[model samples]
Target chain A: MSHAEKKARTTTDEYELIYWPRLPGRGEPIRLLLEEAGASYTDTAHEKDGIQKVVGALKPDFDPGKDNLPGLAPPMLRCGDLFISQSPNIMLFLGERLKLIPGDVEINKYRVNQLVLTMLDLQNEVHDSHHPIAVSLYYDDQKAEAKRKAEDVRNARIPKFFNYFELVIGKSEGPYLLSEFSYADLVLWHLVDGCLYAFPKAMNRQFEKSPKVKELYDTVAKRARIAAYLSSERRQKYDNGIYRYYEELDE
Target chain B: MSHAEKKARTTTDEYELIYWPRLPGRGEPIRLLLEEAGASYTDTAHEKDGIQKVVGALKPDFDPGKDNLPGLAPPMLRCGDLFISQSPNIMLFLGERLKLIPGDVEINKYRVNQLVLTMLDLQNEVHDSHHPIAVSLYYDDQKAEAKRKAEDVRNARIPKFFNYFELVIGKSEGPYLLSEFSYADLVLWHLVDGCLYAFPKAMNRQFEKSPKVKELYDTVAKRARIAAYLSSERRQKYDNGIYRYYEELDE
Candidate 1:
C-alpha cells in the first residue's frame, strides 16, 4: 500500500493541529491537506475550550524546549515530540510524510514550496485588500484605504497571479501544479476558494481569464475527501478572517 | 571533506542568481548564504543589462518549461536545469546543497524554514511600514499612513518578534536560533541589520531589550565573508529597496 493508504488505515491520531476556533484562516489549508491525505489528526478547533487552548499557545514568554520550539502563531502542527508553526512549514513537513508530493523528492519539493509561498503572498495581499494600513485596525477604520487597495488587488495583482497559474497548469503534464496532486495545489485551491468568496464579482472576472485555475479549483473541490471535508462541520466559513467580504471593497 | 568545503572549491558558476541590480532587497539573504558557504555563482545584478534581465524574467506570460519555471519576482536562483523563486524557497534549496543547515536534516530543515519564513514576514512588515497603502503608490502619497504603520511596527511588532528571537537564541544551543549558525540566522541577521539601518532609534531601544538578537546581529556581521561582502561593492546600499530609511517613519 502507498504511504497515504497506510495513513488512511491508521486509527490513532498522530498529528495534533493547534489553531484558532471558528475561522478558516491559515489553518484551513493544513486541515485540507490532512483530510485529503486521510492522515489521522486532531484539531484543537474541535476540542473543548479550543479558543483558550489556542490563546495559551501564544504566550510571548515561552520556552523553546527540546526538539520543540513554540509556534509563533496558530496553525502549529505537533507530531510526537516535534512541534512547528507557519502554514507553509507545516504543509512542507506533512507533504513529505503524507506523500502529497510528485516526481523526485529532490527537485520538486522546492518548486512545491515556491508555489505555496507565492500563493501565501497573494493570500496576504488579499488580506491587506481589506486592511491596507494596519491589521490591528478595524475594517471600519481603514475602509477608504481598503477600497483603493482592493482596486490594485483586483485589477493588477489577481490577474497577474491568475494568468501565471493558468499558464502553469495549462502547460504542466496534469491539471494540478507540478503535474500532480500536491500540497501546492491545496494551497492555491484554498486561496482561490477564499478569493472567490471574498471578492465574488472581481473573482468572476479574474476567473474568466483563468479558466484553468477555476477548473482546478473545481477539480480539487470535487475530490472525494476534499468534497466530504468541505461539507463537514470541520470546514470553517469565511468571516472577519483573512478573506473578508466587504461590499464597498469589492468591485 | 565536508559538503560545504567540497562546494567551496567548485570553480564553475553552476548557480546563477537573477535579481535586481544594485539593491540588497530580498536577495541579501540568498547572497549571504552563498557567500558564507563559499559557493561559486554568477549574479545577474553584476552582469551587463542586469536590469533588463531581471525585468524580462518577470514576464507574466512566460511559459513554465520542462523542469524549469520562471520567478514571479526578483532573487530567482537557477541551478543546473532547475529554476526556482521566492527568496525563502531559494534559501531552503541552497541551504541543503551548501550544507548551511545544522543537526538532523529532517528535523532542522523545517525549523530552519519556519524561522526564515517568519523573518521574511517581518521583512515584509517592515516594507509595509513605508508602503502601507500600496506597494505601487509612492511613499509620499501614503506618508501619513506610513507614519501610522511605522508607529505600530516600532511599538508592537518589533518588540514581539525581537523578544521571541532573543528568548529563542538565548535558550538555543548557542547564540543562534537553532545554534550552529544556519540560514535562519543569516535571514534574521540580514533582517535585523536592515531594521537597524531603517530604525536606528527604535532599534536601539529594541536592541537593549533583545541583547541576544543584537549580539547575533553583530556576530553575523563580523563573519569574515559577510564583513567583506558588506564592505565590497557587491553589497548594495539601501536605496529605495525593501528596507528604506525614512526619517519620519523611523522614530
Candidate 2:
C-alpha cells in the first residue's frame, strides 16, 4: 500500500482486547466504551485459543527473541504497534481517539482521568471486599473476614464514593458527569452495574440516597448503543469477575 | 499587568498542595517532583491551621456558597485555576510543567502514566496491610487481621511488585524507569522509602532478590536535589501514613 493508504488503514484498524474469558471484570469498562462508540474490535477472550493467546501475548518472547513490554495482568489492548495495559490508561487513549472526552481546554482531560482513577479506586475496594485477607486465598477461606470487610464497604466506602459521584452529577449541567456523555460516565455505569450484582440489597439502599447518581445510571443504561450491548450475547455474565454476589456478604 | 506580562507570570506561578497535615501519604510523590524540579510550592500540610486548610478545601462551599469542585480526599494540587486530586493525575500535571516527563513522543507520556498507576496500586496494597478491614477502623482493633494481611503482603505481593519493577528496569537502559530521570523515578523512590519503613525486615529480605530495584532506590536517594529534600525539615516523617512499621507485622 502507498504511505497515505497505510496511514488511513492504521487509523481505521480494529482494536484487539486480551482479557480473561469468563469474567466481565476490568475489561467490561473497555468493552462498554467500544460498544458505546460502535467501534470495531476483537475480544480475544471469546475467541478460540483465547486464553492461550492472552498468555502468549503476556510472554516476553511473544514476538520471538524480542523483549516486548509484558503486561502485569490482562485487560490489555493492542492497536497497530501499540500494546498497553492498565484499564484507565487504555480508556484514556480510546477516549481521546473516539472523542469521548471533551476538548483539551487545559485541564479537561485530566478531569476525566481523575474521575476514572477514582472509579478504579472504588473497583479495587469492591474486589477487596470478597478477598479481604489475601487475593491468594479463596473467598470461602476468608468468609468471615470478607463479611466484615463487605460491611464496612457497604456502610462507609460505598456511601462516600456514591455521594461524591452524586455531587459531581449535581454540579454538572447534564445527563453525564461532564455535562455530556463521556468515558467517565461509561466507567461509572459499569462499576455501578457490577456493584448492583455484587451487593444488590446494599446498592439498592445506597441508590435511594443518591438520586442524581441513580439518574445517571439509568440515563447511561438507556443509551441506544449501551442498551443494545447490555441485552446482546456479547455482554458476558458476572461470575468469577471482580464483582461477585456472595449471599452472606450482602446486607 | 498587560496580557503578555500576565501570561508570563502565570507560567512561573508556584503551586499549593493541600493534604493531610500528618502523614507523608499520597502527597509524597507530588513533593518529590517539586523537590526534584526545585520549583516553588507550598505544602499546606506544614503550615499552621494546615489540617483546617485541607478540611476547608474539601467542603463544597469552601469558596462560600459558590459550588467549587471539592477533592474526594487530599494530595490535591492547585495551580492557577485548576484544582485536581488523585496522586497520579497530579503527577501528570506537574510532570508536564516541570519537564519531569519526556517530551510527548507518541506513547511516551502514556507509558509514564501506566507506571505511575501501577505504583499507586502497590501503594494502595501497602496501606491495606495495616488497615485490612476498613479505613474507618483503628489498627489496634484489627491487629489480628492486619497481621495476617501483612504476612501475605510480605510473602507474596511485595516480591511480585518488586520483581515487576526490576524487570521494567532491566528492560530499559536506565538510571531511571524511562532511561533517564522522570516523575516515575521520583514516585518509585517515595514508595520504596515508605515500604522500607513499613516492612523493614520484609523489604530488606525482598531487596536481596531485586538488585535493580534496590539500585534504583539507592540512586534516587542520592540525587542532589532529592538528597537535600530528604534531609530537609520539609520532608515530613511518616507517622500515620500509608506505610507504617508495625513491629509484629514485619518479619
For each model in turn, which proportion of the native inter-chain contacts is also found? 0.63, 0.65
Worst 10 residues of 1 chain B by lDDT: B4-13
lDDT of 2 at A46: 84
Q: DockQ winner among the candidates?
A: 1
Over B11-113, each residue of candidate 2 has an lDDT whose tens digit, in order, gives: 3667999888777888899999888777789998789988998888777555512222556888888887788888888898888787776645346667787
Candidate 2 yields a Cα-based lDDT of 0.82
DockQ of 1: 0.68
Instruction: For candidate 1, write residues A1-251 as lDDT tens digits.
Output: 36666455344449989888888999999998898888889888899988887888788655435767777788888888788999999999888887787779778888898888889999999998998777788988888778878988988888888887886787675578776678888888899999988989999988878888988899889887889899998888888899999887786
For model 1, the TM-score of its B chain against the native B chain is: 0.93
Q: Which candidate gets the maximum lDDT versus the true structure?
A: 1
> Per-residue CA lDDT of candidate 2, range A1-251, in tens?
24453233233558889998988989999998887777789998689889998888767445412223556777888877777788998898888776677656345777888899898999999999999889889888888888889999999999999988887887786567876567899999988999999999999999998888888899999877789999988899998768999888886
